[model samples]
Target: MGVDIGLEKFLATSDGVLVKPPQFFKTLQGKLKSLQRRLSRKQKRSKNYEKQRLKVARLHHKIDNRRKDFHFKQAHALCDAGDLVFMEDLDYRVSAKGMFGKHLLDAAFGQFRTIVKYVCWKRGKFFAEVDARGTSQKCPECGGEVKKDLSVRIHDCPHCGYKTDRDVADGQNIRNRGIKLMSTVGQTGMETACADELPGVGLTLPRQVSQPRKGKTRKPKK
Candidate 1:
């Protein structure tokens, strides 16, 4: 499966499933702003200032934790959905500087992708990144150019008469690219091995290969 990440939605899969973004920061922005406002009015380095600052800090931390938790759950869900997962290889940091910068940063596409990759490894699913160029502009069905501006939400391919959500088309394109890349590298996508054993194979492996340690356990005295 291929995944497309965007500001409007957290991600849309090639399978046509759209996962709405929780936008944890945006949801809590008002409270965070109020806390910061209170912090600003406090005298610098005073007890009140310190207390307000910590409140603001805690709110920020809460947002981060919520976002991180969301990412992990989504990652695991993706791994569960498919044996192979693909995402566009793009520098989301550059996109974060645009008009929707705050939303993009809040979405944290890069961080989410990293979490997805790690989850795929842990769950024995294959994960890969494909070329990002023109994924949304090209037709997933006919490989024809279907030019449209950012305002366009639907992908109506004139050449192939293919219609679908724009993000879904992009996800399909990414999936095609990943499959092509795997073929180019001679991977049949059926290999089974631990991530450490065949890092480049990009196929499902046994679940026990990368099980994470659950807790810190003290060693018995010799």
Candidate 2:
């Protein structure tokens, strides 16, 4: 199923109201500052410049690897636990070009989804990706437009006083969209009655995880 990787938390209400711990953002800010400092000092194409560039690249690579590891673990766990998985038809080729482009690429949402779908396929589970149109900005309860700037993490509905965790609300909205899409095709989600009766969606086989060649181990085996 499609899931957004965000700081996991609970919702206080229906409207998405994000409440991030002070340290959470402070740590991110610190990392960004470090990256900026390193990036600013390096000359355009000198040897030292290349070295500094690699250093920054390694930092980003480490972050990306860690995030991917987590996503893989979570996706595997979900596949193990559920027989059906539904997610958004995310087109990262276009979406990864925004202000958060680099971060999004590093986060590897597309890769995570591919891994998840592959795992589902391997285990004979259902997998599907539906449209994600207006999933974030639209109110799930009333179908009203909830306009807010990117800086405004809190999704407060002045009309209904509804509030919730931003990511969680988005997940709920995504689930609704997936459900609607499925319904139009004469299908239902796991939450609906008889949803389990529907045929499992198709999935491609997951590629084998690569490893170093047989003699490549740094420590020779006894």
Superposed Cα deviation of residue 120, candidate 2 (Å): 2.0
C-alpha TM-score for every candidate: 0.82, 0.54
| Residue 168 of model 2, lDDT score | 55
Instruction: Indicate the residue-level lDDT of 8 in model 2.
Output: 34
lDDT of 1 by residue, 124-174 (tens): 899999989999899999999999999999999998799999999999999
Looking at candidate 2, what is the lDDT of residue 162?
72
Worst 10 residues of 2 by lDDT: 7-16
Instruction: Assess each prediction's global lDDT (C-alpha) against the native.
Output: 0.90, 0.62
Q: List the pairs of residues colliding in candidate 2.
A: 2-87, 13-163, 15-162, 15-163, 15-164, 17-164
Off-target runs (Cα >4 Å) in candidate 1 are 187-222
lDDT of 1 at 120: 90
